[model samples]
Target: MPDATASILLLGATGQVGHELRCTLAPLGAVHTPGRAAVDLRVPDAIRRAVDEIGPDLIVNAAAYTDVDGAEDAPRRAAAINAEAPRVLAEAAQTTGAWLVHYSTDYVFDGTKRAPYTEDDAPNPINVYSRTKRDGEAAIQAVGGRHVILRTSWMYSRRRSNFVRTMLRLADDTDRLTVVDDQLGVPTWAGWLAEATTTICNSLLGAEGASKAGCYHLAGTGQTSWYGFARAVFAQFGRTDVAVEPVSSDAYDTAAPRPAYTVLDSSRARAAFDLPATTWTAQLDRFCERIGTEKGTPKAPFASV
Candidate 1:
């Protein structure tokens, strides 16, 4: 029982999560998704105007300042989109009596814990980008609107520029690829996230009502390092010629600090809603199928990080 008549507004409709959101929400009611030209997040007034125009029953924010390295230099810009913009949407949703569905990242954790992080775990961000996301989550809660904040990790899709696509492209050129094996988390597919969102929204629309509306961990089933994920991807693509070597995080020096273990516990989401559990390898296989390999392997340039 899907709500095909509820007016909905989707922000950040071009990004990874937003792109999938568009496809998932298409069967639902009149969905409005605006890009920067149509609705700029920096300007709260623009978001207000869009909300007024759409008068949506639900507002899904899938956009954020996702450039981890860039955020180190431009923390203000990151805060504006990731933190302030979410507050603006929450405010607008509250004013319109619409449910706010927001997406967050696993970077909120400092990666000190050995076990998987739960929704109850306190967030301790290690970088500027993560700090902004933490601020956004707080702002959304402070706005006091009916909301569902989904914190996911290692998200990828065939359409966007993510780890999965990057690895696939690199495999075609290089014989050996070195990826950091220290950091661990689930590799979530954008389509899985989109479909999960649709299921929750539909449940909310039905007579049963929303059983739970708060922060929930939504990602793939198993946990693995970036190197392990790359190896799995290569396995699915049938490209054994290329060897994915594991390296330490110290090998890759960047402006932003990545979480070493941001794996989240998703038992809550599964119990609340009838969500399907799919492994990262399974999803990666499907993704590889979508983006076919090159005719012949190209000689790769060996560039060390």
Candidate 2:
């Protein structure tokens, strides 16, 4: 639906991925990122009013309630943001004849399949957070508008509550870290995900992408367990000062039940968009290089750590 002078309405500008998206989407069109006060998703009326007012050719929704364990305690809030909100957005997109791009989670799968999960794999969400995401995907598809729902896993950034940042914090605060090795996924950098989304946005402006509209897996190329990912992070930084230990998922008493494996196969998105195949470890190298160049750390400066 995007033309040369396309108008883009991006939700969740404050988020890790959304923050990167604000700059990445600028070259494509005029990107409008309204704060929560203006586009409060919980208030459906506010969402419709914002969508109607903006009238964007492309609506990229990077926003969603992402607190996995927290969702166990507050399912209603999570559903409001993850399920009902996306449904309303899809309705608005259908009304305005705009293309909607929404993000989903790998947790939608029960993680029973040890192999990489494909797009066709049926979702059997085991937790409240994952269930809401699955509901959101269903609502969008039910609308039958031009949309692409990307299911990704293990998203991280320098400024977020993700595994990467958590490991960095642990590396600074302590030398001994015990991470779960049973749960497997691809640790995708938020910036890279933003760039990939930008590429998809460009392609979606054409005929080919329209035909490929559907749910697709778009995470990192390779996969590893949480313990392996953490070890890789430390290894990238050459953190000999720290020691990492691998344990089972049962080691931690989490509010939500974690799937044993949720690694997504991005082959569908790759074949559709002609995206390059890059591994998670290679991306980790790039991430570490970026952080090494930056001045400060999460708590104690990296220079000292």
Each prediction's TM-score versus the true structure: 0.93, 0.94
**Tens-digit per-residue lDDT, 177-283, candidate 1:** 99999999999888778988888877765666455668888887889999998877666656788887899999988999998999989878877878877787777
| Model 1 clashing residue pairs (backbone) | none
TM-score of 2: 0.94
Candidate 2 local lDDT, residue 150: 90
List, residue by residue over 1-305, the lDDT tens digit for candidate 2.
25448899999999989999999998888999999999999999999999999999899999999999999999999999999999999999999988999999999999999899998889999999999999999999999888999998899877667787678777778989999989888989988899899999989877676787898888878789888888777766566678998898778999999899898999989989889998988777677666663222232324342
Instruction: Report lDDT (CA) for all predictions.
Output: 0.85, 0.87
Judge candidate 1 at residue 133 and give its lDDT: 98
Once model 2 is optimally superposed onto the true structure by TM-score, how far is the C-alpha of residue 277 displaced, in angstroms?
Answer: 0.3
- Candidate 1 at 2: error in angstroms? 2.7
The local distance difference test score of model 2 is 0.87
Residue 182 Cα positional deviation in candidate 2, in Å, after optimal superposition? 0.7
